[model samples]
Target: MAPFLTRLSGRAGFRLAAVSVTAMLALSSCGGSTSRSAPVLPDGADPHAPEVTEISALTFRAPIAAGIIQTSRGGADEEFGLNVTPQWIESSATAVSQIVAGDVQAAQSSYFGVIDAARQGIDVIIVSESYASNPGAASLESMPDSGITELKDLIGKKVAVVSLNSSHAVKIKDSLLDQGLDPAQVEFVELPYGQVPAALQQGTVDASSAQGATLAQVKDTLDTVTIFDYGDGKYNGMAESGWIMKKTFIEQNPNTVAAFQCALLKGTEQVKDEAVYAEILKTDLGFDDQAVASDIAPEFGATIRSEPLQLNADILKKIGSIDEDFDVASITLPTPDNCG
Candidate 1:
């Protein structure tokens, strides 16, 4: 019973219950074992002391827009009193691995990474949010000769995505389940994001599901079929991407975490403001005049329930095909009191 990412009432109980589980798991693990303890500041050391080194944050794309906030507003050194470096990864999978290895302090990851990480006991938390759905970015591009018009039309057709764990795959799965189609009836292939358009062109796959600037670029040439505009109606409540960090890091550096929140929330507010968005495009994002004029990014707001982010757990559970006995009510995390 998968619901579209649309508005659905009566889900608060489910979310709260899930949060309880997350909170328990997060807190209980603190006492279980410790191979390496969290870094501790020396006695008499100032907590607000300025940092001389950079903190590493992994990103999956070019360092622009929100990515700039990590470096320009205040590099890791200024924000964490420690230099914060932004490392770009080609895929979210690499970012997860880096975080697990303690190579990076934070990352902007796909929601799928969060779920997979939790399932693997990585002790991660969603600290902030970024983009959701952009109608222009969710194009369901198809081959010109595929004769595909709507999502339902591709009921049994082969669909291609970068990977089953990728956000594109989640969007494709959620979309198929929402349309009352048997997801297994359709075939899926693991094609890279850049090659999706070409795969569609060659009829290697019936369609390619991709989001963000990539979709915008290939929509016209691929004769993209508009399946569901996640942002068009109220379905935009879906969580497409957000900020995530290790639980141990958040506890050991509460102030740093707060500062991180302030900076990101500030960035969100700035991005929401039309004037600021313009400035970001012209200066921060470094987009050309023509591209900036056409691209419309999603607006952000400061709703920081970092510990327990507002997610569609029921929807996720359904799409993930989690068993009823999986007990989401016994498995979600809690929000911090300081989070707004």
Candidate 2:
């Protein structure tokens, strides 16, 4: 059984988008929403409008960028366009704010957030599965010499995470429960993603749950590795990110949606290629040139179980453990056809 978390945890407009025909058509299908702050595309592709050769979509965080789906380069850079905008928000909770406010077109988010959003009547569709490991990738890390190899060892430990409502915190809580440890056995301190390593160094927190940059930082700076994954042998519902969309948008634009699926699915395949992936991470995603050329690229790929893995119903059920009646599936948008 996956440990239950106590709690868990966008779009742009067209006109400014003049990169590729595919991008223009994608944006054109989006229509116009002047009332909101979200990005607005110019009204469809005017034959008069110049052709967009490529478009840049943002990556939610660094860890997501490390996976096979991101590293591979087989996807249509010309068809779906290229360039991914990377964000600073490290956890699912923060990503939701930007999505609802229309800061970006889509994001890598916790399935729980998508479910919760659906429950709240937000029309969201999970288009793809970004990561799937048996134990899940989220874990507690401590100094090897700290003698803290087990969850029980965290009884009096100070742990750090981005925020209480963030996915990382939820992962920690679930990990503790999986080990039969009271979640409250350790004190959890909230810290920014950038500061997790420093907190550990200063002994401000004995350990922190890391993902992406924080995970990389821990390994590079402290040589830390996982104490244990929260999900252990099960899905634990920690299935990383789900690419989501607004319900209203999907209902109105089937053709456009299908185009996106075909393109992204192709991208997912490309992400699996190590050589191509390395190039995407450093160049398209904008990792430091030195980091890519010298350091190892992050590991990433789409989950095989899902053509674009859908959320686990059991995990959705578990989310209700904290928020009674929270049903993320209630707001699920229609799944795109022939996504496989």
Best by TM-score: 1
Among the numbered candidates, top lDDT falls to 1
lDDT of 1 by residue, 183-213 (tens): 7777876655556667776778887765544
Candidate 2 segments whose C-alpha is farther than 4 A from its true place = 1-58, 66-77, 80-88, 134-138, 163-167, 230-232, 236-238, 284-340
Per-prediction CA RMSD (Å): 10.6, 10.9
Per-residue lDDT of 166 in model 2 = 48
Write down the TM-score of every candidate.
Answer: 0.70, 0.66
What overall lDDT goes with each candidate model? 0.53, 0.50
What lDDT score is found at residue 312 in candidate 2? 45
**CA displacement after TM-score superposition, residue 35 of candidate 1 (Å):** 20
As a whole number from 0 to 100, the lDDT of residue 136 in candidate 2 is 34
